[model samples]
Target: MRVLGVDPGLTRCGIGVVDGAPGKPLRMAGVGVVRTPADADIGERLVLIERGIEAWLDEHRPQFVAVERVFSQHNVRTVMGTAQASAVALLCASRRGLPVALHTPSEVKAAVTGSGRAEKAQVGAMVTRLLRLDAPPKPADAADALALAICHIWRGTASDRLRQAVAAQRLRTPKGTA
Candidate 1:
């Protein structure tokens, strides 16, 4: 399965693509960050993000999109921008009819590293080792994007299967049944 992971932010949104199956080795298809000037109007920044996300979708044609779920932060402005960028990613995936999974930061950290509290450097090191890259991807965000993709590949697949199974069982049961 090919998965595109998005770490959404106004100033520097990270994007990464990975291809792998549940039990197979994962490969990095692409990784990059989308930058929009902080001084740029919010609308303009969103437009830039939309274009960047669309380009990635066209290029990777991922079967699934894994986006970082926006979490509450003390900085309201920062959270707002992140939520906006995340919406753009969700819209892009929806338009393409792709399955979208939202993973929390802690979930991503736990998947890539052993601990949910793993630091950035630890995540970066793990990402490098997992992808067999010569060095960690630059600008932390890029590595984070890759980590999100890797996490989905490792964790999301199982959840997807469970959901499908439940749906199938529901179909097998009578409409009035519990």
Candidate 2:
């Protein structure tokens, strides 16, 4: 499966593409960041993010989009920007009729590094080793994006299959059955 992972932020949104299956080796198809000027108006920054995400969707043509779920933070301003950026990503994927999965930071960290509370550097190191990269992707955000993709590939595929199986079973079962 080909998946595009998005790490949304107002200043620098991370984008990464990965190709892999649940029990197969992974490959990095692409990785980059979308930068918006901090001084720019919020609306303008969102537009820039939309454009950037659209370009990535065009280039990667991923089957699924994995985005970092926005979580609460002490800094309300920071969380607001993250939520806004995340919405842009969700919009872009939905427009393309792509399956979207939102993975929390803890889930991503645990999937990649065996610890939900793993440090950023540890996550980067694990991502590097998992992808067989010569070095960790820069700016932390880039690495985080790749980690999101890896997490989805490892976890989302199984979840999808389980969901499908349950739906199929329900269809096969008689009506009014428990």
- Per lDDT, the best of the predicted structures is 2
Give Cα-based local distance difference scores for all models.
0.90, 0.91
TM-score of each: 0.89, 0.89
State, as a TM-score between 0 and 1, how close model 1 is to the true structure. Answer: 0.89
**Where does the lowest 10-residue lDDT sum fall in candidate 2?**
169-178
Q: Per-residue CA lDDT of candidate 2, range 1-178, in tens?
A: 8989999999999998999998889999999999999999999999999999999999989888899999886589999999999999998886655778899999999999999999999999999999999999998999999999999999998676554455446556554532
In model 1, residue pairs whose N, Cα or C atoms come closer than 3 Å (at least 3 residues apart or on different chains), thus clashing, are none
Model 2 segments more than 4 A misplaced: 161-178
| Model 1 lDDT, residue 25, Cα | 86
RMSD of candidate 2 to true structure, Å: 6.6
Alpha-carbon RMSD to native, per candidate: 6.0, 6.6
User: What is the number of backbone collisions in each predicted candidate, taken in the order shown?
Assistant: 0, 0
Q: On a 0 to 100 scale, what is the lDDT of residue 60 in model 2?
A: 89
